[model samples]
Target: MRSRRGALSEVYDLLRSEIIAGVFDPGAQLVELVLAEKYGTSRTPIREALRRLEQDGLVERGERGLRVRTRSPEEILEIYEVRIYLEAMAASTAAQRRSDFDLIRIRRAQETMDDTSTDDPAAMAAANRAVHETIWAASHNGTVVDLLTRLNNHLTRYPATTLKTPGRWPEALQEHWAMIDAIEQRDSARAHDLARDHMTKARELRLELYRADPSA
Candidate 1:
C-alpha cells in the first residue's frame, strides 16, 4: 500500500495535471468524495491534495465549496503584464549565467518543440513550455522561477492554446530560435529584447482571443 505521504503526493500530481489539462474546467466544483472515488484513493489523500491545491491557487473556496479558479479578463491581462518583464529578465540572466549544460538542456527542449506537430496544439504547447522552463532554470534564479511557475499555472487554466492561433506556430518557433541564439552568444541585451518581444506578441494574441470569446 502506498504510504500516506506518497498517496498525498500522487493524488496532488494527478489533480494538478488534470486541472491544468482542462480536465477540470475553471469554476468546476471539486468534491472530495468524488475525487477520492475517481482516483481510487481514500478521502484522506484527496482532502490533503485539495488543501495543497488551494495553497497553489489552482483551486479556491467558492460560495459553496472548492472550485477551480476562474480569472477575469483583467486578471489575465495583469498576469501577462507581470510575466512579460519576468520573462525578459529570465532570458537576460540566463544569457549571463547559463553553463554549457544549461545550453544543452535548452537546445534539447527547442529540438523537442520543433519535433512536435503543429496539429497537436497540446503537444506543441507543452513543448513550448519546456523551452521556457529550461530558460528559467538557466537563469539560476529560484525566485523568478517560482513566480513564473505560479503565473503560468494560472494562465494554463484556460483551455485554448495561443499556439493554435493562425500562423502563430511558425512565428513562435522563429522567436524561440532567435532567443536561443542570443542566449548562446551571451548577448544579454539582445536576449532581453527578444524575450520581451516574444511575450508581447503572446499577450496580444491572448487579448485578441479573449476579445473574440470572453468565455474562452
Candidate 2:
C-alpha cells in the first residue's frame, strides 16, 4: 500500500538504522541484492539507500561495491578532538542565549538519559545521542547543528560498547548533569569547559578500551 517514494524512504531509514546500531559491522560488504531481499524491496531502493548512506559517510564504495566504514583509534581520537571544539562552542552559545523553554527541554533530555544504566550498547548509544542532540538544539545555530549531525554519524562507527562498562554510565550521567547546570545558570565559560572536559573524558575512556581489546 506504499508509494514507490515511500518504499525508498523506508529502505533508506532501515539501512541507516542498521548501520548506526552496528548491525552492519565495519568493512562488511553491502550487497544490494542481499539488502534488497532483506528489506523486501527492489534493488532500486537498495541502491538509493546505499547512495544516501555514502553521502552521510556511513558507507563507502570499494572494489566490492559498498561497505561500512571502519574506525581506527587514530580516527576516533581525531573525531573526539573535533567534537570537543564543536560541542564546547555549541554549549557556550546555548548558555548565552538559552530561554527557559530551551533549558526545560534540555533538563528533560537529561532526566531521560539519567536512568540509562544498562549494559546494552544500543540503548546507551541512543540515550547518549539524545542528550547531545538536545544540547545542540539549544544552541539555535543551524550550521553547528548540521556539523554535529555529520560528526555523530561518523562517531556511530566506533564501538559503543565502551559506554556499557559498569561505571561509565554513571560518570556520563553526572557529566550531563553538570552541562545542564552550567547552561541553566547561563555560565558560558563553565558550560564550554564542561563540554570539552566531558568529550575529552569519553575519548580517554574509548582509547583505554581500545588498547585493552585484543581485536582493536
Candidate 3:
C-alpha cells in the first residue's frame, strides 16, 4: 500500500506539472490507457492520481472521461477580480514588512524574469510566478499566500504567458520595476496601486486571448 501510494503521488505530480506547463493543453482528454502506457503504470495508480487532481480542481469529468478543466472568460475575469485586490493587498503588506532578505529575493526574481532570452513561455511564466511568490512570502500573511497559491494553480491552465502577449512584456517589466521601487522605498500605497494596475492590464490581455478563442 505504501509503495502504491508513493507511485500514485509521483504520477500526480508529474501529470500536474505537464498540465500546468501546457504539455496537456486545456480541455485535453486525460485518457487513462494512454496515460498509463506513457507513465509505465497501470490504470489503478493513474486513476487514483486523477481523482486527487479532480479534488484539487485541476481536472473534471467530461463526456467520455476525465479532462482538464476549461475556464470561460467570465470565470477568468472573476478570478482576476479577486486576485487584483488580494495581490495588491499582499504587495502593500510586503512593502511595509519586507526585510532585506525579502527585498533580495524579489530583486533576484525580477532579474530572472528580465534576463530570460528564450521565447519559451514556460520558463518566463515560471520566473514570473517566482516574482509574485517572493512578494507573497514577504507579505508575512500565511492565509493570503495560501489563497493566492491555490488560485494560481487554476491559472496555470493558461497555455501561454501573459508576458508573451505582443507589446505587453516590455511594459510589464517596466511596471515591475516601478512596483519594486515602491516596495524598496517602503511606499505601501504606491506598491498597492502599481500591483493593481499590473493585474488590471493582465486581466485585459487574458480576456482578449479568451475572446479570440473561447474554446482555447
Show model 3 residue runs off by greater than 4 Å. Answer: 21-38, 42-44, 61-66
In model 2, where do residues sit more than 4 Å from their true spots? 119-121, 214-216
- Please report the candidate that would top TM-score against the real structure: 1
lDDT of 3 by residue, 1-216 (tens): 459889998999999988876687678899999999999989999999899888777899999789988778877888899999999999999999999999999999999999976578778878888999999999999999988987887787766567878888789789988988999999999999999999999999888887887644
Q: What's the residue-level lDDT of 151 in candidate 3?
A: 80
CA lDDT, every model vs. true structure: 0.92, 0.85, 0.88
TM-score of 3: 0.86
RMSD (Å) of each candidate, 1 decimal: 1.9, 2.2, 2.6
**Rank by lDDT, descending?**
1, 3, 2
Q: For candidate 2, give the lDDT of residue 88.
A: 98
Clashing pairs in 1: none
Model 2, 6-59: lDDT tens digits are 999999998988887778878899999999889998999899888889988899
Candidate 3 colliding pairs: none
Model 3 lDDT at residue 197: 91
